[model samples]
Target: MTPSTWSPAQPPAWFEQARHLAAVRRYQLAEELTRRELAQNPRSPLAFVVLSMLLWQQARYDEAEAAARDALAVQPTYDEAFYFLALSCASQGRSAEARAAIHTAIELDPASAKYYALRSRFELEWHYAAQSRATAEEGLRVEPTNLECLHRRLLALRQLSETSLAEETARNMLALDPECAPAHLALGELLLSQADYVTAEAYFRAALRQQPGLAAARQGLSESWKQRYWLSRRLARLDAWVARAGQWLTARGLGGHLVLLLGFVLVVPVVCLPLCLAYGWSYLRWRLAPAILLVRGRPLGQPCWQCWYRLICPAWRWPWGCWRPTASGARYGASRRPNQSAIT
Candidate 1:
């Protein structure tokens, strides 16, 4: 027998228990309860939406998508179902489908700032930075103080390299909620990108103090700590080439990997041999520079420590020499020299 459709003004007792269980993350009990609810009210769109939410939380995007579609089947005009459908599609990297579903949700509920905020998030992921900003702006217009919309706008600004605007947005967030961890986090990330480790670390620490569970803040703090050491900073700068090379290789797919393998095994040594013969002595000489300075009982200047970069990396000029990339393919400005006081 089809469960009689009644006014869902009062949720069933099991629905309340299931929500509580889900809130506390006892998903198995919650799912069991939800299934029981389904058994009693199999035609309930809300039950399917709840199930979709639970499945989405568990990272079961395919199942969540199906549950959301089931909800839509029960109620063609279910905006909530469309929202979950968009979330599941986005999680599965179906950005176009996600956008389409979210657009439908917005049409169904034009005044929903929540849907707009979510749509802005996926727009950013899809690399529509300008569109994301506009979506976020519209969401803010709908509800001026929506924190999620503000966060999305801040991120879109950051992606567009509008540092001043991003900072302004972050500060506005802090003004609205002084203890917002994500606000602190956004500022910390911006500072980190600008190589202001001290300020970045302070902001990251502040974020962690507010939200002890913020993994991004912890990671930023760790990176700030790592960048404090000279060797670590130089190694990171040196590895920038590796990251670029990996991107180039990735773009070319398997062919680039094959070339890389062949070059490393057969061509690199051949091409490097001549340079090695010429600079092999110089490398050994600098390799022993610290020892030489120590033996001479003279203070080791910065050059003694950093000559390796100058010799091997053509782009690494004298610290603070400041070169820019030219049409000739020269590039510069990866790392900076340590402060004289810090060096001392």
Candidate 2:
């Protein structure tokens, strides 16, 4: 159909539905509808950018990169295209490229909070936790109450091992949004790490209250309980072992235990001696010998017993064995000797 024949209403129906699906995080259906819209209007940069965002959300980084690039090719200054391209690059550990693309995006729209948010995410992935915090701080300066920027800064602090700062950030995040499960979880982790088990348990319980399916908080609580239990058990076992070893040393006497220890030490080496010798012999004959011969520019498969032995141990020299004369040496010798006798 011609561009004129495809009414604005037709594009809006698919685009609006796709956008709604994307809003609810139903990326798969959003992607399908966006593709359908693009089929109708192949040159639609908006459709391509939407599809790229959906692909990125689904963690299909390569496809998202391609789609985002296509969108940028159609509209070089498209902010959304650059944003998704940066996200695709960041997800795949291409931090330098992602940063460059995000810089371009920020240049296109300096006031865009999303561009700064994505840059912060890129810094976090690149192991520049300090830079991530700075980026998030910049975003907060631009949009004072941006929850995303606040969350990013909190996570960056946590990664940098600044637990006290992370706890404060988490409290701020919870004050802003009481149902923030991630903030509660972060607070719990900080508290647990500081050995404040009572407060940590309460935070973990509150996190679960906010989001019943908060697996990470549940797992952290479970693991913390397990670790405390195991720590006490391990200490008890260590104490028992020390007591038993001391009693044994005293009752058996140092000389008797020393003799038994010596015997135990000697037995391992005695058992390993034959295997070690065999391995050393094989290593020298196959690997070291052939390598030395190759270094000396000698034909590795020369008509020598050692070369033949090396050939038999093909694990050392593969194609070298293929050219070994040992297999045909007897025939060559017989042929040469007969010809020499006949001439004589």
**Which has the greatest TM-score?**
1
| Worst lDDT 10-window in candidate 2 | 1-10
* C-alpha lDDT (0 to 100) for residue 117 of candidate 1: 92
C-alpha displacement of 58 in model 2, angstroms?
A: 2.4
lDDT string, candidate 2, 1-344, tens digits: 11111122345667677767776778788788888888889999988887887887787999999999999899999987888888888789887888899999999988867678778877887788999999999988898677788889998998888877888888888888888888889888888778677778888888999888989899878756754676865886798998998887888897869977998899989989999999999977765554444334444344566544553564534555333455646321122123556678
How well is each residue in 77-195 modelled by candidate 1, as lDDT tens digits?
A: 99989999999999998988998999999999888788889999988988899999999999999999988899999999999999999999999999999898999999999999898
Candidate 2 ranges with C-alpha deviation above 4 Å: 1-13, 23-25, 209-215, 226-344
Can you give the lDDT of residue 57 in candidate 1?
Answer: 77
- State the TM-score for model 2: 0.61
Cα lDDT over the full model 2: 0.77
lDDT of 2 at 126: 71
The TM-scores, one per candidate, come to 0.63, 0.61
